[model samples]
Target: MTARVLVAGIGNVFLADDGFGVEVVRRLAGVELPAWAKVADYGVRGLHLAYDLAAADYELTVLVDATARGDEAGTVHVIELDTGRTEQTPCLDAHGMQPDVVLNLLAWLGEAPRRVVLVGCEPEVLDHRMGLSPSVERAVGTAAGAVVDLVTNHGR
Candidate 1:
């Protein structure tokens, strides 16, 4: 059966705090989630994510990534995306997976979830590295819990 919600973990593992999403989802693997919710690690594969979104008719899509919103590093922000806004042109790059680009590609494909949300953490360092910074690593569990809350309490 198709999942009602898609939890997509996206980022580059080699780029320090950019791996926040990937780590958060990894933590989620240990937690119990609803059967209708699906979690995936789509690290740096924006095109793959877009195609998956286009092919499936999900009620909601949650994208987890490291976001720089000018706040303190390791700050987790849950922002709801306005799927109705599709003014930007779609661009696809296999190596670079920007959330906006994936959303634009989904829009271009004429398929979108009913609601879209981003679970983003403020990145400390995006430099080439194998692991997340201390701050970002600390926020991984918080972000994972937030994702769990979102999926379980949706529409309640």
Candidate 2:
């Protein structure tokens, strides 16, 4: 049987520019989508998301987050994590315990999704301030649309 597809957006809304993922999810709230697809605003609970991914009947998982890799503030990129490396490795706990660490651990624990895609946005700032930078906000629509297309095509 074909499994469901989960599209999750993770970030800390309180931090400036860090909330792009969650904002994208919010924009997707009213979009008409196939039944096998689920979209969520996960905030910052990476470990919980890993467990959720493990428990869900999903064959494909799409994760959205912000990356510090220097691109334009609103530039978006998609990456596929290596299943073997993610599953067999212990991730470093840098800058506090990261959610990717949990994702890698879940992969190790046999809860890995059959296919995973990470949609990352380059952020200009991640300060303890309010609102996304103008550039990041501008890319939300394009990113959200891309996510929808990915789910619609891959959810089968």
Candidate 3:
């Protein structure tokens, strides 16, 4: 059976700029989409996201987050992850959702999704502050749109 598509926003809303993914998904929640498109906010629980991916519930997964890619703040990026390059290694902590570990866990499950995309925003601040930084806030909608595009444009 063809798995569905998942758009998961991963980050902590309590931390400044880190909340970009949560905000993006909040915006997406109101938008109309196909039944196969599943959107969720997986804040701080990287392990949860990992197990979900391991379930192979999605043919394609779009993970939205604030990534420190050394780019300008608020920069939106759509990066396609080569899951084939993922290693089948398990992490010690299965309680946290470290993005890299989550992806790796999927490979360890031996049924990783066919495609994984990362829709990230460069964060201005990741300190212990609620809400997104001004720069990151501006990119939320753009990232949401990007996630939608990834799902709709996927060939499988």
lDDT of 3 by residue, 72-133 (tens): 99999998887764644767474344567777776776756678888999999989889888
- Whole-model Cα lDDT per candidate? 0.90, 0.78, 0.81
Write down the worst ten-residue block by lDDT for model 1.
83-92
**CA lDDT, candidate 2, residue 120:** 80
Stronger candidate by lDDT (1 vs 3): 1
Top candidate (TM-score): 1
Model 2: colliding residue pairs: none
lDDT over C-alpha atoms for residue 79 of model 2: 81
Clashing pairs for model 1 are none
Error of 3 at 106 (Å): 2.0
TM-score of 2: 0.86
Cα lDDT of candidate 2 equals 0.78
lDDT per residue, candidate 1, 17-52, as tens digits? Answer: 998999988889999999999999999998999888
- Residue 140 in model 3: lDDT: 85
lDDT of 2 by residue, 87-130 (tens): 34755443322446866777677765677888888998899987
CA lDDT for candidate 1:
0.90
Q: TM-scores, in order shown? A: 0.96, 0.86, 0.89
Span of ten consecutive residues with least summed lDDT in model 2: 90-99
Worst 10 residues of 3 by lDDT: 90-99
